[model samples]
Target: MSDYLRLENVSKTFGGIRAVNDVSFALKQGEIVGLIGPNGAGKTTLVNVITGVHPASLGRVIFQGEEVTRQKPFQAARRGLARTFQIVQPFPEMTVLDNVAAGALFGGSPEGLAEAREHAHRHLAFVGLDPIADQPAASLTLPNRKRLELAKSLAMNPKVLMLDEVNAGLNTGEIDTALDLIRRISERGITILLIEHLMKVVMSVSQRLLVLHHGALIAEGEPQKVVNDQHVVEAYLGEKFAKRLKEMGHA
Candidate 1:
């Protein structure tokens, strides 16, 4: 399969500390991939580099058969690449519908207002937030805020969408909603790269898993296998926790 997005030896450093260390990965069209690691594992930094929020210390970012390592964020968005923040970013003063409509208007789609509103409505319904569409984006609860974020990102109509910890701050019920929405997104033929914390979501949704630690990839494989791998266990899960997970048959 052709890669919809590729990162080659991408590295980002701050002073003497390397936040991302020569990381490399490729995401194919219509695939959902998971990236996870302990705190400060360089996951967010990598996303920043790919989205051009930070320049790669050394490497290239390729999308749609073209090199876009230094391209601006808006440039990447026009090339069918878009991302969501770990924290929701909404136009607090705007109604949810209008906020999402902005993405439709400017997210590389020149469709008219009716078409854009039609598109945003489809995405809002997909996220189960249609009932609250007329409300202010900031007025929604935390889970709904996340839904709105996903909706806004979806409004952009990206081929490859990168999410930074979409499930980080949710309760079980909220997390469930987020997981289901993510599945629905994949069903729409949108490829996803998720940097997530909650293990249940990761193991449940990811086809392939990549583990990072201290700015380096230490494991990549089937979720269960990688989680139980000795090095991965030691690096992230403590020995006791790893063994207990094995005994419980989750590792």
Candidate 2:
């Protein structure tokens, strides 16, 4: 696979606090990347930087061989970079179909809506949301609403899709649905950058894992290896996590 998205020497600060500190990584075409970190670890900040929600304080964002640093959200969308928020925002008044259709209509091309809707329908199907096509987006359950979020982002036809906690607030069954959706998405050739706390979800869905702590990458590797790394264990599990893991035969 070729490089689809790249972030180099990226940094962001709020006053004196560095939200992201010299973070750099490259995402390959069609690779599902798991971006993991504890709260306030700047995982979401990195996502926002790439999506143009918050411009990078320093560094460059390259997409498809071109520099896109500081580009507007709409401009990035036009260039096939789309992201789903941690908070689901839907037009409560609009039907599921219409809500997703708007993504294709606005984010992609006016001419793309008709085509985008067809694609949207398939994507909704991929996310297991087709059965409620005519229902108002606000009426769905939380898990399905998350699916709608994925569908809406899919409708944008992004080359690099950034998903922030798409699996949060889900039950076991709902998480199964989310995993299936993510698997199908990767199968369809959409490169993904997911920031999730669910170890099960990230372990199963991502092809590679990038672990961040305090806005800097500390580990990068296959999921299993990274999970057991001393630094990774410390980041997720407190100081005694190693001993706990040994008691459970994980160490």
Candidate 3:
């Protein structure tokens, strides 16, 4: 299949500092690709560039066969790209359902508030948040907040979803629930680009992994192989992680 999303020689700079340097990759439709890196490794910067939170200092971003290198965030969303922030930003005073309805209203083709609310209800149910649909978003715990973020994005009816650290603060059981939700989303045929720190989640969910270090692409391949790569281990996972994986017969 042709690439659904392509970042060609993409780079981002703030003042004199290069946050993402000449990164290039292609993501196929219906695939879950993991973007993994250490802190300050440009993972979020790259996502920002893709979502148009920050324009690229160099190169192109092609989505669904169109160049959207300079598209604004809302423009990108209108063209079927949606994202969830690492820090959840639900509308505090809105009911959880209304918060998701806002996404349906703004992210895609224009819709009436009633239709948007219906979409919101469907998506909230999809993320298992239907029981609390009437609650204020600010009332949710961390895990449910993450689900709200996911539901909001889903309500946009996006073809490509970029998730930033959706599993960041969840405990093991909650992480498992998040993983299941993600899998269900994937099953619905949304292409996913995931940035996550948890190796187990990334390894289990991703069809491919991309490793970034110091603002550059260092490795891109199957998760198992990428995790075992010497450079990836040295740069992100460390030798101790590699040794432990080997001890567990995973490397």
Query: Which one is best on lDDT?
Result: 3
Cα-based TM-score, every candidate: 0.93, 0.91, 0.97
**Model 3 stretches with alpha carbons more than 4 Å out:** none
Q: What is candidate 2's lDDT per residue for 125-193, written digit by digit as tens?
A: 877789889899889888878889888898888888899998888899888877777777778777999
- Comparing 1 with 3 on TM-score, the higher-scoring candidate is 3
Give residue 53's lDDT in candidate 2 (0 to 100): 85
Query: Stretches of candidate 1 above 4 Å error?
Result: 112-114
For each candidate, C-alpha RMSD in Å? 1.7, 2.2, 1.0
Q: Put down candidate 1 lDDT per residue, 38-97, tens digits, no spaces.
A: 999999888888878898989899988899999888877777788889878799989898
Prediction 1 TM-score vs. true: 0.93
Best by TM-score: 3
Instruction: Sort by TM-score, best first.
Output: 3, 1, 2
Better of 1 and 3 by lDDT: 3
Better TM-score candidate (1, 2) = 1
In order, candidate lDDTs are 0.85, 0.85, 0.91
